[model samples]
Target: MPRLRYIEESEKTPQARAMIESAHKTGAPDPRVVSIMTRSEIGSAWVELWNKVLYEGVLPHKLKEMCRIQISVAHQCGYCSTVRSNVAKAEGLTEAMIEDLFRYETSPHFTPREKAALRYANLFKQGEQAIDKDEVYRDLAKHFTDEEIIELGQLCAQTDGVGKFVKSLNVISWEEACEINPKLTEARAEAAE
Candidate 1:
Protein backbone atom coordinates (compact mmCIF):
# COMPACT_ATOMS: atom_id res chain seq x y z
CA MET A 1 0.00 0.00 0.00
CA PRO A 2 1.14 3.57 -0.68
CA ARG A 3 2.16 5.74 2.23
CA LEU A 4 -0.03 8.42 0.70
CA ARG A 5 -3.50 7.81 -0.65
CA TYR A 6 -3.90 7.75 -4.42
CA ILE A 7 -6.06 10.67 -5.42
CA GLU A 8 -9.24 9.71 -7.21
CA GLU A 9 -10.20 11.39 -10.48
CA SER A 10 -13.62 12.45 -9.19
CA GLU A 11 -12.10 14.12 -6.15
CA LYS A 12 -9.26 15.79 -8.02
CA THR A 13 -9.04 19.53 -8.48
CA PRO A 14 -9.39 20.83 -12.02
CA GLN A 15 -5.62 21.10 -12.33
CA ALA A 16 -5.05 17.59 -11.06
CA ARG A 17 -7.81 16.30 -13.30
CA ALA A 18 -6.17 17.85 -16.33
CA MET A 19 -2.83 16.36 -15.44
CA ILE A 20 -4.39 12.97 -14.89
CA GLU A 21 -6.16 13.18 -18.21
CA SER A 22 -2.91 14.08 -19.93
CA ALA A 23 -1.23 11.08 -18.35
CA HIS A 24 -4.12 8.87 -19.43
CA LYS A 25 -3.65 10.07 -23.00
CA THR A 26 -0.08 8.82 -22.76
CA GLY A 27 -1.55 5.36 -22.05
CA ALA A 28 -1.62 3.96 -18.51
CA PRO A 29 -1.73 6.60 -15.79
CA ASP A 30 1.34 6.39 -13.61
CA PRO A 31 0.50 5.51 -10.01
CA ARG A 32 3.24 7.86 -8.85
CA VAL A 33 1.47 10.75 -10.51
CA VAL A 34 -1.72 9.81 -8.72
CA SER A 35 0.15 9.69 -5.43
CA ILE A 36 1.62 13.10 -6.14
CA MET A 37 -1.83 14.39 -7.01
CA THR A 38 -2.91 13.86 -3.45
CA ARG A 39 -1.01 17.03 -2.66
CA SER A 40 -2.90 19.23 -5.06
CA GLU A 41 -1.06 22.47 -4.40
CA ILE A 42 2.44 21.11 -4.81
CA GLY A 43 1.47 18.33 -7.17
CA SER A 44 0.01 20.66 -9.79
CA ALA A 45 3.18 22.70 -10.04
CA TRP A 46 5.31 19.55 -9.97
CA VAL A 47 3.30 17.92 -12.72
CA GLU A 48 3.67 20.91 -14.97
CA LEU A 49 7.39 21.19 -14.36
CA TRP A 50 7.87 17.46 -14.72
CA ASN A 51 6.17 17.44 -18.09
CA LYS A 52 8.28 20.33 -19.31
CA VAL A 53 11.51 18.79 -18.15
CA LEU A 54 10.77 15.39 -19.60
CA TYR A 55 9.15 16.44 -22.86
CA GLU A 56 10.61 19.82 -23.79
CA GLY A 57 14.40 19.75 -23.98
CA VAL A 58 17.32 20.21 -26.33
CA LEU A 59 18.49 16.66 -25.82
CA PRO A 60 16.55 13.87 -27.46
CA HIS A 61 13.80 12.66 -25.15
CA LYS A 62 14.90 9.05 -25.61
CA LEU A 63 18.35 9.74 -24.16
CA LYS A 64 16.77 11.53 -21.22
CA GLU A 65 14.57 8.52 -20.56
CA MET A 66 17.60 6.27 -20.60
CA CYS A 67 19.41 8.53 -18.17
CA ARG A 68 16.39 8.51 -15.91
CA ILE A 69 16.33 4.72 -15.87
CA GLN A 70 20.05 4.57 -15.14
CA ILE A 71 19.71 6.96 -12.23
CA SER A 72 16.69 5.05 -10.93
CA VAL A 73 18.59 1.80 -10.90
CA ALA A 74 21.60 3.38 -9.16
CA HIS A 75 19.31 4.85 -6.54
CA GLN A 76 17.49 1.57 -6.07
CA CYS A 77 14.25 3.34 -6.87
CA GLY A 78 12.00 0.56 -8.04
CA TYR A 79 9.16 2.84 -9.10
CA CYS A 80 11.38 5.01 -11.27
CA SER A 81 13.29 2.04 -12.66
CA THR A 82 10.08 0.37 -13.78
CA VAL A 83 8.35 3.45 -15.17
CA ARG A 84 11.39 4.88 -16.94
CA SER A 85 12.28 1.50 -18.42
CA ASN A 86 8.84 1.27 -19.99
CA VAL A 87 9.10 4.83 -21.24
CA ALA A 88 12.48 3.97 -22.77
CA LYS A 89 10.87 1.07 -24.62
CA ALA A 90 8.14 3.33 -25.97
CA GLU A 91 10.87 5.67 -27.17
CA GLY A 92 12.41 2.80 -29.20
CA LEU A 93 15.16 1.48 -26.94
CA THR A 94 15.60 -2.25 -27.34
CA GLU A 95 15.03 -4.43 -24.29
CA ALA A 96 18.46 -5.97 -24.69
CA MET A 97 19.96 -2.50 -24.42
CA ILE A 98 18.08 -1.72 -21.24
CA GLU A 99 18.92 -5.06 -19.67
CA ASP A 100 22.56 -4.43 -20.52
CA LEU A 101 22.49 -0.83 -19.26
CA PHE A 102 24.34 -1.66 -16.09
CA ARG A 103 27.03 -3.18 -18.20
CA TYR A 104 27.27 -0.23 -20.57
CA GLU A 105 31.03 -0.10 -20.49
CA THR A 106 31.22 -3.52 -22.15
CA SER A 107 27.73 -3.93 -23.63
CA PRO A 108 27.89 -4.23 -27.40
CA HIS A 109 24.47 -2.59 -27.53
CA PHE A 110 25.58 0.86 -26.32
CA THR A 111 27.58 3.27 -28.39
CA PRO A 112 30.58 5.21 -27.12
CA ARG A 113 28.47 8.37 -26.76
CA GLU A 114 25.81 6.58 -24.78
CA LYS A 115 28.42 4.99 -22.57
CA ALA A 116 29.80 8.44 -21.84
CA ALA A 117 26.38 9.74 -20.87
CA LEU A 118 25.61 6.74 -18.68
CA ARG A 119 28.98 7.08 -17.01
CA TYR A 120 28.15 10.67 -16.24
CA ALA A 121 24.82 9.58 -14.83
CA ASN A 122 26.52 7.06 -12.56
CA LEU A 123 28.91 9.74 -11.32
CA PHE A 124 26.00 12.11 -10.78
CA LYS A 125 24.27 9.47 -8.69
CA GLN A 126 27.39 9.11 -6.62
CA GLY A 127 27.07 12.78 -5.58
CA GLU A 128 28.06 16.31 -6.51
CA GLN A 129 31.80 15.87 -6.32
CA ALA A 130 31.84 12.85 -8.56
CA ILE A 131 30.33 14.91 -11.35
CA ASP A 132 32.63 17.81 -10.50
CA LYS A 133 35.75 15.83 -11.17
CA ASP A 134 37.76 17.20 -14.09
CA GLU A 135 38.23 13.73 -15.54
CA VAL A 136 34.48 13.19 -15.77
CA TYR A 137 33.88 16.46 -17.62
CA ARG A 138 36.79 15.76 -19.98
CA ASP A 139 35.38 12.35 -20.85
CA LEU A 140 31.95 13.84 -21.40
CA ALA A 141 33.34 16.56 -23.67
CA LYS A 142 34.89 13.94 -25.91
CA HIS A 143 31.42 12.66 -26.84
CA PHE A 144 28.98 15.49 -26.08
CA THR A 145 28.93 19.15 -26.96
CA ASP A 146 28.92 21.51 -24.03
CA GLU A 147 25.20 22.14 -24.43
CA GLU A 148 24.39 18.45 -24.61
CA ILE A 149 26.46 17.84 -21.50
CA ILE A 150 24.51 20.53 -19.68
CA GLU A 151 21.22 18.99 -20.75
CA LEU A 152 22.31 15.52 -19.71
CA GLY A 153 23.52 16.81 -16.35
CA GLN A 154 20.25 18.58 -15.67
CA LEU A 155 18.24 15.52 -16.64
CA CYS A 156 20.30 13.33 -14.35
CA ALA A 157 19.91 15.76 -11.45
CA GLN A 158 16.18 16.15 -11.94
CA THR A 159 15.65 12.41 -12.25
CA ASP A 160 17.69 11.80 -9.11
CA GLY A 161 15.74 14.35 -7.12
CA VAL A 162 12.30 13.21 -8.18
CA GLY A 163 13.11 9.51 -8.08
CA LYS A 164 14.51 9.76 -4.57
CA PHE A 165 11.46 11.70 -3.42
CA VAL A 166 9.05 9.05 -4.71
CA LYS A 167 11.18 6.19 -3.45
CA SER A 168 11.57 7.71 -0.04
CA LEU A 169 7.84 8.18 0.32
CA ASN A 170 7.21 4.50 -0.31
CA VAL A 171 4.09 5.51 -2.18
CA ILE A 172 3.68 2.43 -4.34
CA SER A 173 4.07 -1.10 -3.13
CA TRP A 174 6.27 -3.55 -5.02
CA GLU A 175 3.23 -5.39 -6.40
CA GLU A 176 1.65 -2.13 -7.51
CA ALA A 177 4.79 -1.01 -9.27
CA CYS A 178 5.17 -1.38 -13.03
CA GLU A 179 7.22 -4.42 -13.88
CA ILE A 180 9.66 -4.61 -16.77
CA ASN A 181 7.73 -5.89 -19.80
CA PRO A 182 8.08 -9.64 -20.00
CA LYS A 183 8.09 -9.68 -23.77
CA LEU A 184 11.04 -7.34 -23.82
CA THR A 185 12.95 -9.49 -21.36
CA GLU A 186 12.26 -12.56 -23.46
CA ALA A 187 13.43 -10.74 -26.56
CA ARG A 188 16.62 -9.71 -24.83
CA ALA A 189 17.31 -13.29 -23.74
CA GLU A 190 16.73 -14.65 -27.20
CA ALA A 191 18.93 -12.04 -28.80
CA ALA A 192 21.83 -12.96 -26.52
CA GLU A 193 21.98 -16.41 -28.12
Candidate 2:
Protein backbone atom coordinates (compact mmCIF):
# COMPACT_ATOMS: atom_id res chain seq x y z
CA MET A 1 0.00 0.00 0.00
CA PRO A 2 1.06 3.57 -0.54
CA ARG A 3 2.34 5.47 2.49
CA LEU A 4 -0.53 7.96 2.27
CA ARG A 5 -4.23 7.61 1.77
CA TYR A 6 -5.16 8.12 -1.83
CA ILE A 7 -8.37 9.66 -3.04
CA GLU A 8 -10.64 6.72 -3.44
CA GLU A 9 -12.79 6.56 -6.57
CA SER A 10 -15.85 7.06 -4.45
CA GLU A 11 -14.59 10.44 -3.30
CA LYS A 12 -13.18 11.72 -6.54
CA THR A 13 -14.38 15.18 -7.52
CA PRO A 14 -16.62 15.37 -10.58
CA GLN A 15 -13.85 16.69 -12.85
CA ALA A 16 -11.33 14.12 -11.73
CA ARG A 17 -13.95 11.43 -11.93
CA ALA A 18 -14.54 12.31 -15.55
CA MET A 19 -10.87 12.21 -16.30
CA ILE A 20 -10.53 8.83 -14.63
CA GLU A 21 -13.44 7.55 -16.66
CA SER A 22 -11.97 8.89 -19.85
CA ALA A 23 -8.47 7.60 -19.23
CA HIS A 24 -9.87 4.20 -18.42
CA LYS A 25 -11.56 3.98 -21.80
CA THR A 26 -8.44 4.84 -23.71
CA GLY A 27 -5.59 3.23 -21.82
CA ALA A 28 -6.94 0.79 -19.25
CA PRO A 29 -6.36 3.16 -16.38
CA ASP A 30 -4.92 1.64 -13.26
CA PRO A 31 -7.06 2.68 -10.34
CA ARG A 32 -3.96 3.06 -8.21
CA VAL A 33 -2.50 5.59 -10.62
CA VAL A 34 -5.75 7.52 -10.49
CA SER A 35 -6.13 7.14 -6.76
CA ILE A 36 -2.65 8.39 -6.08
CA MET A 37 -3.21 11.18 -8.52
CA THR A 38 -6.47 12.15 -6.87
CA ARG A 39 -4.87 12.04 -3.45
CA SER A 40 -3.27 15.27 -4.47
CA GLU A 41 -5.03 17.53 -6.90
CA ILE A 42 -1.48 18.70 -7.58
CA GLY A 43 -0.55 15.26 -8.76
CA SER A 44 -3.64 15.09 -10.91
CA ALA A 45 -2.70 18.45 -12.30
CA TRP A 46 0.72 17.17 -13.25
CA VAL A 47 -0.80 14.14 -14.93
CA GLU A 48 -3.29 16.26 -16.77
CA LEU A 49 -0.43 18.29 -18.11
CA TRP A 50 0.99 15.11 -19.57
CA ASN A 51 -2.11 13.15 -20.57
CA LYS A 52 -4.18 16.01 -21.89
CA VAL A 53 -2.58 19.38 -22.23
CA LEU A 54 1.06 18.83 -23.06
CA TYR A 55 1.75 15.46 -24.62
CA GLU A 56 0.15 15.90 -28.02
CA GLY A 57 0.87 19.59 -27.99
CA VAL A 58 4.60 19.19 -27.64
CA LEU A 59 5.76 15.91 -29.10
CA PRO A 60 4.71 12.86 -31.02
CA HIS A 61 3.54 10.30 -28.48
CA LYS A 62 5.90 7.60 -29.71
CA LEU A 63 8.98 9.79 -29.64
CA LYS A 64 7.98 11.25 -26.31
CA GLU A 65 7.58 7.81 -24.80
CA MET A 66 10.90 6.71 -26.27
CA CYS A 67 12.59 9.64 -24.58
CA ARG A 68 10.89 8.78 -21.31
CA ILE A 69 12.04 5.17 -21.54
CA GLN A 70 15.59 6.37 -22.04
CA ILE A 71 15.40 8.67 -19.03
CA SER A 72 13.93 5.98 -16.83
CA VAL A 73 16.88 3.81 -17.77
CA ALA A 74 19.34 6.60 -17.09
CA HIS A 75 17.87 7.24 -13.67
CA GLN A 76 17.63 3.54 -12.81
CA CYS A 77 13.98 4.18 -12.08
CA GLY A 78 12.28 0.84 -12.42
CA TYR A 79 8.89 2.35 -11.72
CA CYS A 80 9.28 4.68 -14.63
CA SER A 81 10.81 1.89 -16.66
CA THR A 82 7.94 -0.47 -16.01
CA VAL A 83 5.23 2.09 -16.47
CA ARG A 84 6.72 3.46 -19.65
CA SER A 85 7.31 -0.04 -20.88
CA ASN A 86 3.63 -0.69 -20.56
CA VAL A 87 2.88 2.55 -22.31
CA ALA A 88 5.29 1.63 -25.05
CA LYS A 89 3.48 -1.64 -25.54
CA ALA A 90 0.15 0.08 -25.76
CA GLU A 91 1.57 2.44 -28.33
CA GLY A 92 2.51 -0.56 -30.50
CA LEU A 93 6.19 -0.49 -29.69
CA THR A 94 7.54 -4.00 -30.14
CA GLU A 95 8.93 -6.17 -27.35
CA ALA A 96 12.32 -6.00 -28.99
CA MET A 97 12.05 -2.21 -29.01
CA ILE A 98 11.26 -2.21 -25.31
CA GLU A 99 14.09 -4.55 -24.37
CA ASP A 100 16.44 -2.76 -26.72
CA LEU A 101 15.91 0.38 -24.68
CA PHE A 102 18.27 -1.07 -22.11
CA ARG A 103 20.81 -2.09 -24.72
CA TYR A 104 20.28 0.28 -27.60
CA GLU A 105 23.86 0.64 -28.66
CA THR A 106 24.06 -3.04 -29.47
CA SER A 107 20.49 -3.64 -30.60
CA PRO A 108 19.30 -3.38 -34.16
CA HIS A 109 15.82 -2.62 -32.84
CA PHE A 110 16.80 1.02 -32.49
CA THR A 111 17.01 3.07 -35.66
CA PRO A 112 19.72 5.63 -36.00
CA ARG A 113 17.28 8.45 -35.33
CA GLU A 114 15.83 6.59 -32.39
CA LYS A 115 19.32 6.01 -30.99
CA ALA A 116 20.10 9.67 -31.47
CA ALA A 117 17.04 10.66 -29.53
CA LEU A 118 17.79 8.19 -26.78
CA ARG A 119 21.39 9.35 -26.62
CA TYR A 120 20.17 12.91 -26.44
CA ALA A 121 17.93 12.02 -23.53
CA ASN A 122 20.79 10.25 -21.77
CA LEU A 123 23.23 13.05 -22.46
CA PHE A 124 20.76 15.64 -21.25
CA LYS A 125 20.36 13.70 -18.04
CA GLN A 126 24.15 13.43 -17.71
CA GLY A 127 24.61 17.24 -17.65
CA GLU A 128 26.21 17.70 -21.03
CA GLN A 129 23.31 19.83 -22.14
CA ALA A 130 25.20 22.03 -24.58
CA ILE A 131 27.30 19.46 -26.38
CA ASP A 132 24.58 17.97 -28.56
CA LYS A 133 21.89 20.57 -28.15
CA ASP A 134 21.84 21.43 -31.81
CA GLU A 135 22.85 17.99 -32.96
CA VAL A 136 19.68 16.44 -31.56
CA TYR A 137 17.66 19.25 -32.98
CA ARG A 138 19.20 18.51 -36.35
CA ASP A 139 18.48 14.82 -36.05
CA LEU A 140 14.92 15.46 -34.90
CA ALA A 141 14.39 18.02 -37.60
CA LYS A 142 14.72 15.20 -40.06
CA HIS A 143 11.69 13.51 -38.53
CA PHE A 144 9.59 16.10 -36.67
CA THR A 145 8.67 19.74 -36.80
CA ASP A 146 10.00 22.62 -34.69
CA GLU A 147 6.90 22.47 -32.50
CA GLU A 148 7.65 18.83 -31.91
CA ILE A 149 11.07 19.62 -30.49
CA ILE A 150 9.60 21.71 -27.69
CA GLU A 151 6.97 19.07 -26.98
CA LEU A 152 9.54 16.29 -26.90
CA GLY A 153 11.71 18.26 -24.50
CA GLN A 154 8.72 18.84 -22.24
CA LEU A 155 7.87 15.11 -22.23
CA CYS A 156 11.46 14.25 -21.29
CA ALA A 157 11.30 16.70 -18.42
CA GLN A 158 7.99 15.33 -17.18
CA THR A 159 9.32 11.77 -17.20
CA ASP A 160 12.39 12.85 -15.26
CA GLY A 161 10.22 14.73 -12.81
CA VAL A 162 7.99 11.72 -12.28
CA GLY A 163 11.02 9.45 -12.10
CA LYS A 164 12.50 11.57 -9.33
CA PHE A 165 9.27 11.36 -7.34
CA VAL A 166 8.88 7.61 -7.87
CA LYS A 167 12.48 7.13 -6.77
CA SER A 168 12.10 9.32 -3.67
CA LEU A 169 8.97 7.43 -2.65
CA ASN A 170 11.05 4.25 -2.73
CA VAL A 171 8.86 2.94 -5.51
CA ILE A 172 11.95 2.36 -7.59
CA SER A 173 11.41 -1.26 -8.56
CA TRP A 174 8.27 -3.29 -8.77
CA GLU A 175 7.85 -6.97 -8.58
CA GLU A 176 4.93 -6.94 -10.93
CA ALA A 177 4.94 -3.19 -10.53
CA CYS A 178 4.31 -3.55 -6.82
CA GLU A 179 1.35 -5.74 -7.64
CA ILE A 180 -0.67 -2.95 -9.11
CA ASN A 181 -1.82 -5.61 -11.51
CA PRO A 182 -1.10 -9.29 -11.26
CA LYS A 183 -1.29 -10.08 -14.96
CA LEU A 184 1.36 -7.49 -15.74
CA THR A 185 3.86 -9.22 -13.49
CA GLU A 186 3.13 -12.56 -15.01
CA ALA A 187 3.33 -11.25 -18.54
CA ARG A 188 6.54 -9.38 -17.83
CA ALA A 189 8.14 -12.44 -16.35
CA GLU A 190 7.09 -14.58 -19.27
CA ALA A 191 8.62 -12.02 -21.58
CA ALA A 192 11.86 -12.07 -19.64
CA GLU A 193 12.53 -15.76 -20.19
Candidate 3:
Protein backbone atom coordinates (compact mmCIF):
# COMPACT_ATOMS: atom_id res chain seq x y z
CA MET A 1 0.00 0.00 0.00
CA PRO A 2 1.12 3.56 -0.64
CA ARG A 3 2.14 5.81 2.24
CA LEU A 4 -0.48 8.35 1.15
CA ARG A 5 -3.86 8.23 -0.49
CA TYR A 6 -3.89 8.20 -4.28
CA ILE A 7 -6.29 10.74 -5.70
CA GLU A 8 -9.08 9.08 -7.61
CA GLU A 9 -9.62 9.95 -11.25
CA SER A 10 -12.79 11.81 -10.42
CA GLU A 11 -11.10 13.76 -7.65
CA LYS A 12 -8.15 14.88 -9.73
CA THR A 13 -7.87 18.46 -10.89
CA PRO A 14 -8.30 18.99 -14.63
CA GLN A 15 -4.57 19.43 -15.20
CA ALA A 16 -3.71 16.42 -13.10
CA ARG A 17 -6.43 14.38 -14.79
CA ALA A 18 -5.11 15.31 -18.24
CA MET A 19 -1.56 14.38 -17.28
CA ILE A 20 -2.69 11.06 -15.85
CA GLU A 21 -4.78 10.34 -18.92
CA SER A 22 -1.85 11.17 -21.17
CA ALA A 23 0.43 8.86 -19.22
CA HIS A 24 -2.19 6.12 -19.28
CA LYS A 25 -2.53 6.49 -23.05
CA THR A 26 1.22 6.03 -23.29
CA GLY A 27 0.66 2.68 -21.48
CA ALA A 28 0.94 2.46 -17.71
CA PRO A 29 0.49 5.61 -15.72
CA ASP A 30 3.42 6.17 -13.38
CA PRO A 31 2.26 5.24 -9.87
CA ARG A 32 4.31 8.07 -8.38
CA VAL A 33 2.18 10.55 -10.32
CA VAL A 34 -0.95 8.96 -8.93
CA SER A 35 0.34 9.11 -5.37
CA ILE A 36 1.55 12.67 -5.77
CA MET A 37 -1.84 13.67 -7.18
CA THR A 38 -3.22 13.95 -3.67
CA ARG A 39 -1.65 17.39 -3.77
CA SER A 40 -2.90 18.65 -7.13
CA GLU A 41 -0.70 21.73 -7.43
CA ILE A 42 2.50 19.92 -6.64
CA GLY A 43 1.35 16.97 -8.69
CA SER A 44 0.63 19.12 -11.73
CA ALA A 45 4.01 20.81 -11.56
CA TRP A 46 5.77 17.56 -10.96
CA VAL A 47 4.07 15.89 -13.91
CA GLU A 48 4.90 18.81 -16.19
CA LEU A 49 8.55 18.86 -15.18
CA TRP A 50 8.87 15.11 -15.41
CA ASN A 51 7.41 15.15 -18.90
CA LYS A 52 9.77 17.90 -20.03
CA VAL A 53 12.81 16.24 -18.57
CA LEU A 54 12.07 12.79 -19.96
CA TYR A 55 10.64 13.79 -23.30
CA GLU A 56 11.63 17.26 -24.44
CA GLY A 57 15.40 17.25 -24.81
CA VAL A 58 18.17 17.58 -27.38
CA LEU A 59 19.51 14.17 -26.42
CA PRO A 60 17.87 11.07 -27.87
CA HIS A 61 15.11 9.88 -25.59
CA LYS A 62 16.61 6.40 -25.49
CA LEU A 63 19.88 7.70 -24.08
CA LYS A 64 17.98 9.73 -21.49
CA GLU A 65 16.01 6.67 -20.45
CA MET A 66 19.19 4.63 -20.17
CA CYS A 67 20.78 7.33 -18.05
CA ARG A 68 17.69 7.36 -15.83
CA ILE A 69 17.87 3.61 -15.27
CA GLN A 70 21.57 3.85 -14.45
CA ILE A 71 21.01 6.64 -11.94
CA SER A 72 18.21 4.68 -10.30
CA VAL A 73 20.39 1.59 -10.12
CA ALA A 74 23.30 3.56 -8.66
CA HIS A 75 20.94 4.88 -5.97
CA GLN A 76 19.60 1.36 -5.29
CA CYS A 77 16.12 2.71 -5.86
CA GLY A 78 14.07 -0.35 -6.70
CA TYR A 79 11.01 1.55 -7.85
CA CYS A 80 12.86 3.96 -10.13
CA SER A 81 15.11 1.23 -11.45
CA THR A 82 12.18 -0.98 -12.36
CA VAL A 83 10.21 1.77 -14.05
CA ARG A 84 13.14 3.18 -16.00
CA SER A 85 14.36 -0.25 -17.01
CA ASN A 86 11.00 -0.90 -18.62
CA VAL A 87 11.11 2.47 -20.32
CA ALA A 88 14.59 1.72 -21.62
CA LYS A 89 13.35 -1.57 -23.07
CA ALA A 90 10.45 0.17 -24.72
CA GLU A 91 12.89 2.63 -26.22
CA GLY A 92 14.66 -0.32 -27.93
CA LEU A 93 17.36 -1.16 -25.42
CA THR A 94 17.81 -4.92 -25.46
CA GLU A 95 17.26 -7.09 -22.38
CA ALA A 96 20.91 -8.03 -22.46
CA MET A 97 21.82 -4.34 -22.40
CA ILE A 98 19.67 -3.73 -19.35
CA GLU A 99 21.13 -6.74 -17.59
CA ASP A 100 24.63 -5.57 -18.48
CA LEU A 101 24.09 -2.08 -17.11
CA PHE A 102 26.35 -2.53 -14.10
CA ARG A 103 28.99 -3.96 -16.40
CA TYR A 104 28.83 -1.15 -18.95
CA GLU A 105 32.58 -0.71 -19.04
CA THR A 106 32.93 -4.17 -20.54
CA SER A 107 29.45 -4.55 -22.07
CA PRO A 108 29.40 -4.96 -25.83
CA HIS A 109 25.98 -3.31 -26.15
CA PHE A 110 27.08 0.19 -25.20
CA THR A 111 29.07 2.60 -27.35
CA PRO A 112 32.02 4.62 -26.06
CA ARG A 113 29.69 7.62 -25.82
CA GLU A 114 27.16 5.69 -23.80
CA LYS A 115 29.82 4.29 -21.47
CA ALA A 116 31.07 7.81 -20.80
CA ALA A 117 27.56 9.05 -20.06
CA LEU A 118 26.83 6.10 -17.79
CA ARG A 119 30.10 6.68 -15.97
CA TYR A 120 29.12 10.31 -15.46
CA ALA A 121 25.77 9.27 -14.04
CA ASN A 122 27.44 6.89 -11.61
CA LEU A 123 29.94 9.54 -10.58
CA PHE A 124 27.14 12.07 -10.10
CA LYS A 125 25.32 9.64 -7.87
CA GLN A 126 28.42 9.40 -5.68
CA GLY A 127 27.93 13.08 -4.64
CA GLU A 128 28.23 16.69 -5.70
CA GLN A 129 31.93 16.67 -4.89
CA ALA A 130 32.54 13.82 -7.27
CA ILE A 131 30.65 15.45 -10.16
CA ASP A 132 32.17 18.89 -9.54
CA LYS A 133 35.67 17.72 -10.35
CA ASP A 134 37.19 19.12 -13.59
CA GLU A 135 38.54 15.73 -14.66
CA VAL A 136 35.06 14.29 -14.84
CA TYR A 137 33.83 16.96 -17.27
CA ARG A 138 36.98 16.62 -19.39
CA ASP A 139 36.50 12.89 -19.68
CA LEU A 140 32.80 13.29 -20.51
CA ALA A 141 33.66 15.86 -23.21
CA LYS A 142 35.84 13.36 -25.06
CA HIS A 143 32.59 11.62 -26.11
CA PHE A 144 29.87 14.26 -25.64
CA THR A 145 29.47 17.84 -26.73
CA ASP A 146 29.10 20.48 -24.02
CA GLU A 147 25.36 20.66 -24.66
CA GLU A 148 24.96 16.88 -24.66
CA ILE A 149 26.99 16.57 -21.47
CA ILE A 150 24.89 19.22 -19.73
CA GLU A 151 21.65 17.60 -20.81
CA LEU A 152 22.87 14.20 -19.67
CA GLY A 153 24.09 15.63 -16.39
CA GLN A 154 20.70 17.20 -15.77
CA LEU A 155 18.93 13.93 -16.46
CA CYS A 156 21.21 12.07 -14.08
CA ALA A 157 20.77 14.70 -11.36
CA GLN A 158 17.00 14.74 -11.70
CA THR A 159 16.74 10.96 -11.64
CA ASP A 160 18.96 10.77 -8.58
CA GLY A 161 16.99 13.39 -6.63
CA VAL A 162 13.54 12.24 -7.69
CA GLY A 163 14.33 8.57 -7.22
CA LYS A 164 15.58 9.17 -3.68
CA PHE A 165 12.64 11.45 -2.87
CA VAL A 166 10.08 8.85 -3.91
CA LYS A 167 12.01 6.09 -2.19
CA SER A 168 12.04 8.09 1.02
CA LEU A 169 8.28 8.39 0.90
CA ASN A 170 7.96 4.60 0.65
CA VAL A 171 4.80 5.15 -1.34
CA ILE A 172 5.17 2.19 -3.68
CA SER A 173 7.54 -0.67 -4.29
CA TRP A 174 8.41 -1.85 -7.82
CA GLU A 175 6.46 -5.02 -7.10
CA GLU A 176 3.43 -3.03 -5.97
CA ALA A 177 3.71 -0.84 -9.06
CA CYS A 178 3.97 -3.90 -11.33
CA GLU A 179 6.87 -2.23 -13.12
CA ILE A 180 9.01 -5.29 -13.78
CA ASN A 181 9.56 -6.28 -17.42
CA PRO A 182 9.45 -9.97 -18.35
CA LYS A 183 12.54 -9.68 -20.54
CA LEU A 184 14.56 -8.26 -17.67
CA THR A 185 13.27 -11.00 -15.38
CA GLU A 186 14.34 -13.64 -17.86
CA ALA A 187 17.73 -12.01 -18.38
CA ARG A 188 18.30 -11.77 -14.64
CA ALA A 189 17.48 -15.46 -14.24
CA GLU A 190 19.80 -16.36 -17.08
CA ALA A 191 22.62 -14.29 -15.62
CA ALA A 192 22.23 -16.06 -12.29
CA GLU A 193 23.04 -19.33 -14.02
Best by TM-score: 3
Q: Could you give me the TM-score of model 2 versus the true structure?
A: 0.72
lDDT of 2 at 172: 36
Q: What lDDT score belongs to each candidate, Candidate 1 first?
A: 0.68, 0.60, 0.68
User: Candidate 1 — which residues are off by over 4 angstroms?
Assistant: 27-31, 85-87, 174-193
* Error in Å for residue 32 of model 3: 4.3
**Tens-digit per-residue lDDT, 119-193, candidate 2:** 666666665454356776777788667776666666667767766776555433555353653444433343233
Worst 10 contiguous positions by lDDT, candidate 1: 184-193
lDDT of 3 by residue, 73-183 (tens): 555555665664345456787756767876778888998888888788778877899889889988988988888887887788778887787666666564443355544
Q: Model 1 misses residue 188 by how many Å?
A: 18
State the local distance difference test value for candidate 2: 0.60
List the lowest-lDDT window of 10 residues for candidate 2: 184-193
lDDT value for model 1: 0.68
Please list the residue runs of candidate 2 whose C-alpha ends up more than 4 Å from where it truly belongs after superposition.
22-30, 53-55, 84-91, 128-133, 171-193
